[model samples]
Target: MNQEFYHELGHVVLHIGNQRQMTDSFRRYKESKANHFMYHACVPTFMI
Candidate 1:
């Protein structure tokens, strides 16, 4: 649940507008970035 929250938060923080008009590739890129963010947010470098 906490990871999910950070994933969405990554979207809100990194993306600032509607995503309905984005291209498929760009959407995938954004999702990838969010996933990266979620991973880092959930597990900081110091904890690794």
Candidate 2:
């Protein structure tokens, strides 16, 4: 599950970097967004 989800997320990241409106859609899917700790932890890397 993690592998598949990670790959899907990778695609999202690619799309975000390539498109503007796509990031809005991606952000919408994230709901409330990552918690503070998770955001901080992933900040240097992904961060939602």
Candidate 3:
């Protein structure tokens, strides 16, 4: 319903009137490796 979603969908669908999916998409994989890898990568702390 949003423009950004439609824009991204268009890129994935080749402007076709159907939805398309990406393969080997690690980013979307639940329990994705990025979670494990990026965990604790960023945090705010006060130190002298």
Write the number of the candidate with greater lDDT, choosing between 1 and 2. 1
* Candidate 2 residue 27 C-alpha distance from true site, Å: 24
lDDT of 1 by residue, 1-48 (tens): 988999999999998666898898999999999999999899867888
Candidate 2 local accuracy as lDDT? 0.45
Q: Please give the distance, in angstroms, between residue 26's alpha carbon in candidate 3 and its true position after superposition.
A: 27
> What are the TM-scores, per candidate, against the unseen true structure?
0.84, 0.30, 0.28
Model 2 lDDT per residue over 24-48, tens place: 7666554323232233444445536
Index of the highest-TM-score prediction: 1
Model 3 residue pairs with clashes:
none
Candidate closer to the true structure by TM-score (higher is better), 1 or 2: 1
RMSD of each: 1.8, 10.5, 10.7
User: If the candidates were sorted by their lDDT against the true structure, best first, what order would they fall in?
Assistant: 1, 2, 3
Query: For residue 1, what is the lDDT in candidate 1?
Result: 94
**Which residue pairs show backbone clashes in model 1?**
none
What C-alpha lDDT do the candidate models reach, one value each?
Answer: 0.90, 0.45, 0.38
Alpha-carbon error at 13 in model 3, in Å? Answer: 0.1
> Model 1: residues >4 Å from true position, as ranges?
44-48
